[model samples]
Target: MSELRRFLEQLTAAPSAEALWDLHCSKMAEYGFDRIIYGFSHYMSETSMGDPEDFILLTNHDPSYMELFIGNGLYRDAPMVRWALHNVGACSWRFLWDEMARGALTEREKQIIAINQRHNVTAGYSISFKAITSRSKGAIALTAREGMTQAEADEIWAEHGSDIVLMNNVAHLKIVTLPHQSTGRSLTKRQREALEWVGDGKTTQDIAMLMGLTSATVEKHLRLARESLSVETTAQAVLKAAFQNQMFIVDGIQG
Candidate 1:
């Protein structure tokens, strides 16, 4: 297997969230991207589903370029941020620029692009993923030197899809490691099943019918979910469960 494949296999075998994050960072450095950043919202707190705040921000750029990025808050108006908000999958810099050209861009955005070009950061690729916690999301971006071609971008995406997914998963794990309740009452099998259904956007009535329970019974289970997660509403319960890695939605599981 290729190194990327081996790394992914290792990630699959990782026994803890910390181990997974370390593996992801090491493998990402091996992929030769100039920079990578993963961010999550405030949802992941205590469960076993994934971490929302845990992120890995890596860069191989010169110290000066890094300094410039932070000094100007370029990340605030970055094209990658736009791409992550609008696109849910993988894409490249050329395509990103092409899309930007077709959209209305502020002078600040244009200036950021100009700065990137001046620094020879002419090409980039990103694979964005939806955050299971909160309403926030994130992506992993890889940038290349000037004159890089679309073929190279595609090659990187094809070669590194699994690594990108693994990185995101580990990031989720880290978000759940915040100092708080480390151990709580374990979720019952039925609670776990119901939580997964809720995460998939199922209505209580629908879940009741699917599980062959009364709608009131469904509500009772959801009430338990809310109390167990210490959240006020079902939505908060679902989001909290997701962020804390307490519940894994069947549909959201990636290979």
Candidate 2:
């Protein structure tokens, strides 16, 4: 077996969230990628559930891209952001060029892509995951400079897909280990219903009609779901709820 495969097997056997994060970082290093960032938007704040924002950020990029990413709000317009919004499982940096060619690029997004190109960041891949309870919707991004081939990308994806899933699962396990005072309360029935609907790919209007409630009421429930889960968006809320088994799976369609 490859070293990365062995690491993943060990991670699967591990009993702790920290151990999983450690294994993930080690595997990313083995892949020859210059940077790996795993971010959970829902768990960015409110650590009642054991700090879900705890991340493993590995990078050899010049500090300049880091500065621009944070200082200039490039993250808001990043192609990764768009991918997350659309719930894409995996994507390449080349998609950014395709988006630009299609005239779908915003000025800020174009600028960030340009900066990355100038910095020799030839390509990257991002994988998003459903959030665990007390956590946020999450994504793991691996970036590399020139010479990263499609075969290499496919190898990383096949090798590390389970690791990404386990990362969020272990994070939730950590929350379950926390004291009652540290962990937040469970979801309400209405919140659960809304989450199930969202996980089924039902829009707010669709859910409202199904439940005999106004769309605004459905929106309110979703908003509460997001706040209670410490997630910033509805999609994150659905992801987290599904991870916790508080929401049911229907049609195999995730929110």
What's the lDDT for all of these models? 0.62, 0.61
Q: Please tell me which predicted candidate would have the highest lDDT against the true structure.
A: 1
Q: Give candidate 2's whole-model lDDT.
A: 0.61
Tens digits of lDDT, candidate 2, 98-143: 8889999888778877877776665667766554433455566777
Q: RMSD of each candidate? A: 10.3, 12.1
What residue runs in model 2 are displaced by over 4 Å at the alpha carbon? 1-5, 12-22, 43-63, 133-135, 145-255
TM-score of each: 0.51, 0.50
Which window of ten consecutive residues has the lowest lDDT sum in model 2? Answer: 175-184
- Model 1 gets an lDDT of 0.62
Q: What is the TM-score (0 to 1) of candidate 2?
A: 0.50
